[model samples]
Every structure is written in structure tokens, then in C-alpha cells.
Target: MDGSCDDVGGERTALEDVGVLLADQGLSDAFFLERGLVKYGDAEAGNLVVVQVDEDGREHELVTGAGEAWLELRDAAQAEGVLLEMVSAYRSVERQAEIVRGKFLRGLGVDEIFAVSAAPGFSEHHTGRAVDISTPGYGVLEEEFEESAAFGWLEENAGRYGFTMTYGKGNAYGYLYEPWHWVWG
Candidate 1:
């Protein structure tokens, strides 16, 4: 009852072939990345699951599995006086593309953008399993959120809900430390 998405193929081997993809539109539509498996397009056709995380009717969709766990985590945090809010949730390919474009227009080179942002099709947001969380008194998506009481609470308890902070101050992934970004297992 977790969730589902497109399944491409199950068997994978180091390919001796490497070639250029003129475009990845169809390729992406035919596959998806998941926590532990590769998904083919048909899996998402009728069973792709998402859920709204906000009461504002914005349809802030998140992968159903993560959405359910996030709700539980949020409630638990609230009970402890630590309120968590979703500032950014699932993003479509189009939206991710726009974000990268905007960053380029703002003078960020591709390398710099990739350091802080994922390049469209390569974004975690595409899977609907990643979220940018925030709380009261600090700006959404700001590093300052790291110093908030909410972050402290999450640091101590998020793993209980199958969540993990993706980028830490000096860890791996070659991306900027993103304390606000959490991905569900």
C-alpha cells in the first residue's frame, strides 16, 4: 500500500553502450526512479499515487507513501510544539525545467545551479518523494531554518518516520548542504 509509478525494466547491467539522447521526454515518461527499484511507464498509467499535503486546495501532491508518513510526522511534531510546514513539494518536469531556467537567468552557471539545484529530469522532486520543510519564524527554503527549534526536533525524530536529511554541512552528494530537504525511504 505504499505507492506506485511507471516501471521500465527490472534487469540492469553495466552497459557497454553509451550514446546521446536527442531528448529524454519519452524516455522519462517510460521510466522513473524510486528508492529501491526502477519503474516503467505503465505502472504509473493507472496506479501512480499522489496526495495533497495542504489544506489550501493547491493540490500539493506528494508520492502517496511519503505523504502518509509526512502527515504522521507532522502530527507528532505538533504534539511536541514543533510545527512543520511544507514549503515545496512534488514538482513536475515542466516546473523543474522552469526553476533551472530561472536560475540561469539570474546568473548562475550550469555548474553552480547543479550545485544547489537539480537539473530538471534529474531532480528528486520529480519522484514526488522529496520535500522542502520549514517552520514558523524563518523563511521557507532558507538555511536559517536549520537553526530553528523545528529543525532540532526533526534532527532528533525524523528518522522514526522514514525520513532522512539529504545534504548535510559537509557530507556527500556533491550538492550544497540542504538541511530543509528530506526524502522518505
Candidate 2:
């Protein structure tokens, strides 16, 4: 697969090659990346379901139908001795903006932050269908996660729960490869 991890029977796929999963069919109209996020607004957000992240009960919200799959995936991993944890999930536009604002305060320009964090409305977290996962040893959202046992577990089993790793090594999304960021399809 070289730097690109998405391969389809000898061919490769990119973001444009697939549909971006949203919180619900209704959220398709949220907002786009270039316009920049001014506010967070999802009509369906009110009905989002909050689920326990793991046995310790960290809570995270996702669209109505995702909680069960998350639990199922967690249980599956636990069976294999992996303690799954959530670093982030269901972020709001305001939260995303705050993250960007914090980065800027620390000297990162908008373009620099955009390369790593999606501008408010453009973030998958807006849909509540995306989650940044973590295992204790690898830290959160680090490239080193790719070398962990948890990463291998996800690569092998996440699909059965309808989860997919969105960014690959040379992905076209411009975001860095995120072995920890997964979208529930």
C-alpha cells in the first residue's frame, strides 16, 4: 500500500473516492471546510445518545444508532485483552473552534491548524459518528498508535462494527494519518 493505506484489489481510494459519513442523513447540510466554521449547529444533536466509553464509564455521545456498536466493539477488544478508551468524541463547533483558538495562541496559524484539526463545522466529530480512540501506553492521537497492539486489533476488527479509519498514510484528506480516528459508518 506504500504510503497510502486504502487499496481496493490493487487500486487505491481517496476521500473523493468515498462518501463521508455523517451523524445522520439530515446532517448532510451542516457546513463545508473552506467557509470556515462560525457556529456549531446540528438539529439532530439534541437527540444524540451518550454512551459509556468502557468499564470505567467515561461518557461520549454519538448519533442514535452508534452506541451499541461502540459497546460491542469494546467488548470484543476486551475479550482479546485490549482495554479500549476514548480520547474524544462528539465535539461541537464551539469546541473545535476553541481547539483552534488554543493552537493559535500557541503560535500556530490557521493553515497550520487546519492541516491537523478540522475547522469547526467541517469536523467529523460534528456528526458524533467519529471518535479518537486510545490505549493507555500509546497516548492519544499520536502516530505511535500505529505501532500498538490496539491498532492491530482495530485494523482487524473495527470493520465488523461498521467503523473505518478515515485517514491513511498518504490520504487525500490532507489530515495526517489517524490510526486512532475512526468514523462509524
Candidate 3:
């Protein structure tokens, strides 16, 4: 990935580009920008990218992981019959900005907004090192997915593949506890 805004045609680069841009803009303390995609649980830097077929049957290409951690994780989940599926991945910086703006408009305070939205150029999706996985028939990150055998298997084995949960209980950094999200280290 070029990770440049030009390639994205002013749509803002992927989350990785946003992270880099934010670092250049001096918001380093707010969040650490991710570089590439990885499994949803890897602690290494980067955003989660995934490929998903939406309910509309549209194939969406997501930027995630620097290599094959995502594939391995997906395979592991499948081997266990966990029924894993990706919902969203590799969000562009422009899209992230829009999400932030939407949240702001929806009454999220400045701090609250930043807590969830990457301040442009400071996102991980640019690196294609992150992923969002869920069980089939589950709407997004449903509670069942969070507690399902697939999730548990990942939690127990993702680290071996350099993947870690991006957010979960007791995590004080970046967004809320998203059981469905992971990153490759």
C-alpha cells in the first residue's frame, strides 16, 4: 500500500495514513497510529483490515495485516467451526473523519469523540494490519460472538501468531472493548 492521500483521491488515506498524518500534526499523545494490518488480537502496531461480503452480496476489500496472521487466525477459527466472518476493515481517513464528525454531531463531547474516532492520519487501517471478525448470522459484533468459542480460541492462540485484541475489558487505550477486533503484531 502506498499509504499516500494522492492514491486515495482526496478520500483520505487508509487508517495508517491518518495515523501518520496525525503524528505529523502533533496529536501523538491522543493515540498511537497503526502502520499495517494484522490479526485482530496482535498487539503490534497497525489497524485491522478485512474482506467481507455484505448482506447485499457486495465484496468489500479491507486493509489489514502486514502478512498472513489474519489468514491463520481465520483458518484457526474455521477449524474449530467457529463460523467467523468479517464485517468492516481498512477505513479510509476521510471516512474516519466523517465518522468523527457524525459522532460529534450526535452529541459526543470532544474527548469522547477522539476516544473513538481517529483524528485523521492517525488511524491503523492504512497499514492493512488489523481485522474485525465475527460469527456468521451474527449482526456485527454481537455479544454471542464475543463470548463464542471462536473468540475464546483466538484469545488463547492469537498471540502465537502475533495477534492480540485491540480493545477489551480493562484496556485503557483506544476505543471501547471490541471483542471482534484484532491486530497482528
lDDT of 3 by residue, 1-185 (tens): 22432333245334444444445445453334342212222233343333556788855444344445666767877787766666655665566656654554355664676555556545555345656777756557655667677788887888988877776765555465678877665
| Candidate 2 lDDT, 46-75, residue by residue in tens | 557887555677678988766678879989
Predictions: Cα RMSD each: 10.7, 13.5, 8.4
What are the lDDT figures for the candidates, one per model? 0.65, 0.68, 0.57
Model 1, span 1-185: residue lDDT tens: 01111121123211100001102123232232322223322122222344544676666667778888988999999999999988877776556656655564455654576568664455666677777899989988778999999999999999999999977896454577888999887
lDDT score for candidate 2 against the true structure = 0.68
Give the distance in Å from residue 157's predicted Cα in candidate 1 to where it truly belongs: 0.9
Query: Which pairs of residues clash in candidate 1, taking residues 3 or more apart in a chain or in different chains?
Result: 6-39, 6-40, 7-39, 7-40, 8-39, 8-40
Poorest lDDT segment (10 consecutive residues) of candidate 3: 35-44
Off by over 4 Å in 1: 1-57
Top candidate (TM-score): 2
lDDT of 3: 0.57
Q: What's each prediction's TM-score?
A: 0.70, 0.73, 0.62
